[model samples]
Target: MALQIFNVLGREKQLFQPIEPGFVRMYVCGLTVYDYAHIGHAKNYIAFDVVVKYLRHSGYNVLYVQNITDVGHLRDDGTDPIIKKALRAQSAPMQIVEMYARSFFEDMDALGVIRPDISPRASAHIPEQIKMIQTLIRKGHAYEVNGSVYFDVTTDPDYGKLSNRRIDAQQAGSREEIRGEKRNPEDFALWKNAEPEHILRWDSPWGEGFPGWHIECSAMAKKYLGDTFDIHGGGIDNMFPHNESEIAQSECANDADYARFWMHVGSLTVDGMKMGKSLGNFVTIKDALKRYRPEVIRMFVQSAHYSSPIDYSDDAVQGVARGHERMMNAVRLTRRALATAPQTDDGNAILAAVEKARADFTAAMDDDFNTPLATAALQELTREVNALLNSGTTVGASVLKAIAETYDQLGGAVLGIIPATDDSAAGNASREAGLIELLIKLRSEARAAKNWKESDRLRDELAALGVILEDRADGTVWKVN
Candidate 1:
């Protein structure tokens, strides 16, 4: 099935057709490395990560590039964000960038957000940015003002195509004097003049200046993924002005579409307001990782569609944690069944149900990478497997292997909700599984022998070890907490 994506360009869902057959080139706007990444950032990257994962799973060779803005991103007062962080920390701006950039990688790794193939930092691509700015100027779409360059939005006929905002409505001297250096108020900066005190400034054709926020992404994306790419994605907040400026500079300079698909993930809120550090309601990715497992957090992010707002709280993550554990327990039970059952006939109701679920999972993923629906299919498979396990009917080894492999393919390989079954994680998991089974057997024997106090004590002991036990009529079920 051809994947369908909601392209923000036309505000409609369209079937995804890459520029090159059998390959996808994707670029996701990355973060400014001034501070630690937050939960809002987590949702943004994970959304694109799943997109890339599913695309690869569907047999496309994907080249994913996510740029890091260590310089040029400015505050409202026209100061570099990294410079501001440097001032606060009593260190150099690059030091702050290095510190947080390392933390960003660590935090995203913890969240299971896959690293991009090319992590092109803006500071590293200074020459490429300068060249793009020069091209915009040579093409008569930009002008210089006192060692700074600005992209003249009026030069482009379809300036507001990506964002619905009109670029033809600016009247000279009719607006506030916010952008005094710009020819038009809507004209975005391509390069900014840096003061002598600024430490991150580089020598450009204009003078000792730095790349603007919008121009960095334009240059980096073109450098790594070429003028036209399959997908360009970021948070919806980047739709206006930021991404809009990128569209103008890239297409005007390269004379081609900037990106075929403009995908934007929804914002994350807290309580009822946007999550921000100044708002004091924001949760850092560091803090959230301390409490929840990475897979639990992935499940929480995948619970809703990518383009939907997520209201985050402890309650939200905890709810998803329970759901994630249930899914993992189902995988464990299927693995157990596979390990012990005899190799015989596979014709059974359970086998048919598992095959149908595998098909459903693929169908759900192909439809705009609908992770919630895909996860639902897996959960249904779990339910079917649990019923078969408790039906008092012997499930053959072939049937159990099919069920386990199906779960591993869709659950672990595609969605990444399940951990990898290779390496030390698998070894440690096996050890834990054996210990958990022993405890379950001891507790079950205590219950059958009418030793109520002994069973309760054993359950309490397991609880202290973070193992949750559910005693069904047929047997005991256990999952790691």
Candidate 2:
């Protein structure tokens, strides 16, 4: 089946056809770089990362671009979080941006998200933004007043095409602080007049000012990916004013479509509300990592559809971690079996199961990147593979290799829930697995000798270290807790 994407622009699922044959140009709005990336950020970025991975895995040469906003992410009252963070840290605004930007990438890397091909910073592309704003002004789509520029929403009849908002219905000049200067309440800023004390000031056509939060994405995306790209993505919360305004200004200035498909990830919530720093209910990615493995977090994100909200809690992530341990156990055991399996072609059933699993996984992913279904296919295959391995069947090395390759491709490469190595905290290394097996054997001997004290001591020690041993009638099997 061909890939279908839920494009927010048209409000329907459409077949994904890149502009250029066998190539895709995609852009996603990036972080503002004032604070640590939170689980919400992880959900959004990981969703897009999966999309990019699947595109490349499908043989498309993808040019992915995500921007960094160092300046012009303004609050309702004209305050920049970057500047506020700078003041609190006793540093420059750029210093705050640099620090948090690197931290964001660090968290993403730990989660195994592939980095974009181009990471254009907003501050570095002032010329491009200024030029885009100049074009808007020249085309009468925007106007400059009192050393500030605002996109004239009244001029674009299709202003609310993305957000489905009507200009007359919106409370014009709702923000009294900038209402007096803006022609309409729905009008949004392309450039803001920087204050004398503002540290992140730049010289623009409007005056000494900074680019507005919305303009940076439009300018940067166009500069890197052109006016109309294959896909544009961001959080759903930004759909209304931020994304809506981008369409108005870009289409008006460039005389073309902004992006072909719009994909927005749903919010990551806590206690039925959005997880945000302002809400004080957010968990930073670093803090979450300290509590759970990165793959565990990624699995939790994949448990829900990208457009469906997933709640965060300690209990939720713990459940995901347990399930991840079970999945990795199947993978680890298969690799171990490969070393000892017979050479005879007597495992055609397992090979057929692997083929069926591959087909099911691809179909699920092709259906709007439905990760939960795709992952379910893998989990089902794991169950079948486990039963065969534990049933004392004469499985061949070729069958084990095929099973391992399916997990490595669909789970490791596509979903990214499976790591390339078992050396991660989430999975026991081969050496560690061997040592645990040896200890299990010793504990068995102790039990056989009726030395309950030594047997219990070994069991308790392993449990303390999160190695859970299940004693079956045949023998004992262990899994990472």
Candidate 3:
């Protein structure tokens, strides 16, 4: 099947034909960096990360750009997020931004999320933003009011086309109660005048102020990816006002389509409740990595399609942990058998089935990046390899190599849900290794002395620490669970 994406602009699935052959230019909205990145942030960013990974796997030279909003992200109550955070922490706005931005990258790195090719900070791109706002004003799509500039939505006939909001069909706002500077309530701020106490300000032609939250992405994306890119992605919540405004201002300023395809990931819920700071139910990536491994978290996120909402819980993550462990164990088993397999052909029929899973994986991912189905295909490969390995059948050398490649390429490279075979986690266990070795010695002594209770307790304690001990034919060998 041809690749298809559910573009929010069209509100239906459309073939994702690239603007240029064998190349994809993609942009995703990133964090405001006012607070710690939470599960909701993980949901959006991880989805986009998988998209970029799959595109590269499919032979697309993808240029991915994600913006960092260090300023001008106002809350629903018209309060600056960074300023409010600074007040609470007794720090400056830029200080808060720098602190959280570093922590955010650290968290993402722990989760194996690929860093974007270019991560432009809004505060650093004041000139580009001013140029875009100036272009809007010169084209009559925006007007300066006092010391601020607002997009003239009525000037663009297709203002709400992205969000499917018909301008004439909607009731007009009460113009009498003009609280803000905009002539129309639908007209959003392109650049707002910085208040006297505003910590972040830039000298724009309109006034000394920062870029709006929506304009930051447009400015940075255009600077890196050009006027019209292949895909623009973010959370579904962004489709209404934020993305809609992006479309309006960008198309008007550039006099071209903003993004060819709009892909929005679904929300993340915590135990059936929507994740929010006010609700106190959100899980941060820092907290998540402290318990579960990164691959397990990836498996948890990819269990469902990108468009589906996932609920987070300890039980759910534990189930994912078990599933990820099973896949890894199968890889380990197949590799061990391959090490000693004969060079001559054994004509094992299971190898053929395992190889076909490679095609299945490609097909699943090509169909709009159906990662859950792709993961299922990877599991099928694991199962076939394990079946042959466990059946005491030595597969041919070439077939063994094929199985290993499928596991590495599709499972490791494309899905990124499989940790590397030489991952440093094993090396990092030196201290634990010494502790585990001592315990193993004690357990051996207990078994030798016929202390059954003590031996069982030692084994049980190790198991609790995610170290499983198996009594082999010669002795016990421990592997991380």
Candidate 4:
């Protein structure tokens, strides 16, 4: 089956035909690097990582580019006082860019996300951004106000096409207050006039200032992937002003569509509330990694479809941990079964099951990269593999190899949840034992105080951490896996 993905533009799944046959060029908008990444950031990046992985596995040469936004993102809330804190902290703009850029890579690496082929920073492509802005000005799509350049929303008839918003229909002056020079409230900045205190300023034809957030993406994406690319991806939150403005600026300047497919992943929520720094309910990826294995975190993000909101909670993560372990157990059993199963030529049933699972998985993924369905298909295969083990069936060497290969291709190469066999398993066992003992002591005190939520939370967290606490009629006993 040909691979298909839901084009957000058309709001339906379409067969994926790359601009260049047999090759795919993809871009994902990356972090702004003002702070440590949260789980929401993880969901966006990991979802796209799986897409890139599956595309490559399906025999497409993929050139993936994810940008590092080390500059130009402003403090949306007016009260923060210090705008562009990241740029001002370092001795030079490049220092700030490299510092946060490296940290972003480190966090992504810990989450098992494969690094992109090219990670261009906004600061490095100033020339390209300036050139694009100049083109927009020459094309009469933009105008200069003092040192700042603003994209005239009135100039482009298709200004809000990406977000499906009409410029005239929008609430006037609802967003950031328009400067006196702006022609309309909907017009967005292409270049900002840096204040004397602005530390990240650059000398340009528009005078000393930095590129706007949307302009950086248009400039860098076109610089690397040309005027049009196969796929452009980001969080759904970017759909309105950020992505919509990108389409307007790029299309107005280049006289062509900006991208073929616009993919937007949904946000990650905490207890049904959106997770953001301003909300003060956000958990950093580093804090999450300290508790759960990186593979477990990746599985948690992939459990839901990319286009659907994923509610994050202790219970939700624990459920994912259980599911991930079940998958790993199947992998281990398959490996052991392969090692000892008798070699024969008559194991075609198992071979057929494996092939069927692969075909089903590919088909589900072809339908708009339905990861949730693809994940269910993997679970079904795991059940079948376990059932074959329990049935005491004799398997041929070729069939065993095929099963192992399929598991590795889907679980390891694409979904990226392969279990690691290492000395850390022993360490995990010791840690669980220690944690269980500590929790039991705490539970005793909680029970005496009638703190039900505390006791239950402690018990649930321990169980989710892979420590099973069995409460018998007589008493509670714990076991560490």
Report the lDDT tens digits of candidate 2 across residue range 328-378. Answer: 888877876676678866676887778888999999999999999999999
TM-score of 4: 0.84
lDDT of 2 at 25: 98
Residue-pair clashes per candidate? 0, 2, 0, 1
Stretches of candidate 4 exceeding 4 Å from the true structure? 77-94, 169-179, 345-348, 420-481
> What TM-score do all the candidates reach, one by one?
0.93, 0.93, 0.91, 0.84
Off by over 4 Å in 1: 170-173, 421-450, 470-478
Return the lDDT, model 3, position 276.
79
Better of 1 and 3 by TM-score: 1
lDDT of 3: 0.83
Alpha-carbon deviation at 131 in model 2, angstroms: 0.7
The lDDT ranking, best first, is 2, 1, 3, 4
lDDT tens readout by residue for model 1, 18-51: 9999899999999999888998899999999899
TM-score of candidate 2 to 2 decimals: 0.93
Model 4, residue 206: C-alpha shift (Å): 1.9
Best by lDDT: 2
Model 4, 58-91: lDDT tens per residue?
A: 8999999999887787766521112455445735
